[model samples]
Target: MLIYANRDAVEAWSREEAPDNVDVLIRRASAMVGVATRMARYEVTPAGLPADDDQADAMRDAVCAQVTVWDKAGIDPTAVETEGRVSKTSMDGASFEYDRAAELSERTRVASTLCEESYDLLRLAGLIGGRPWQR
Candidate 1:
């Protein structure tokens, strides 16, 4: 008593879903790198690690690469407070970087989960009679 739909429909759906999942993953990775960058900067400002300007620049460069990936994926880079500076705000008399590390971590996890789910969906659709690759 089961009715089967067209194979093309399922294949189309899987293809449509995969890009969205990949986009989410890319965005999450970008945000995580951004937060990590801000944290590194904060640590440097307070004389925490690296203890030198050159090392800090290197860390910034790594973060910038992540930002580039986000840009390519059509995700908005974190907003800058100044033309060439990260946003910093004073809250409760304490300076807080706009980069929310905890939130970024959570988002990255969610994006990863989505990616796994999307992959499983694709596999299932293929097993359930999706289209074959043309090449």
Candidate 2:
């Protein structure tokens, strides 16, 4: 239940007033971030946010970006319905087919819940993967 983004933070990141379900969005987004960054260990604040200011802000922005994408997609994050990119298309029949979600379980999570902006935010924050160099 670690919520990385609040109403005010989400609103500021999105540059728009948050919706009534902002808490719900934050919960879902935070869960997605946890899953996405399970490999990276970060020092957290007393409130459970990243200790590094930049990383913490990036996390908030990433969560907010995810919320914005979910809000735009109109998909209920709490629901079990499958929604995402089209998997199949037919040129002749003019048919389109969407991919059904793979089996879902608490531990069998997927990255489809994350949006592009969120991914980029985490990447830039050095949370997803670090940039190593030698001088």
Best by lDDT: 2
> Candidate 2 lDDT, tens digit per residue, 1-135?
677889998888778888888898898889988777777778988877789999888888989998887666565577644444347878977988865544333212322457767878988988886422110
Candidate No. with top TM-score:
2
Where model 1 places Cα greater than 4 Å from the true spot, the runs are 1-31, 34-43, 47-50, 76-135
CA shift of 122, model 1, Å: 34
| Candidate 1 C-alpha lDDT tens digits along 1-135 | 111112232234333322333433334443443333332333334434334555433333333333333334444333212223346889789997665665555444433322332323333422112222210
Q: Model 2: clashing residue pairs?
A: none
TM-score of each: 0.25, 0.69
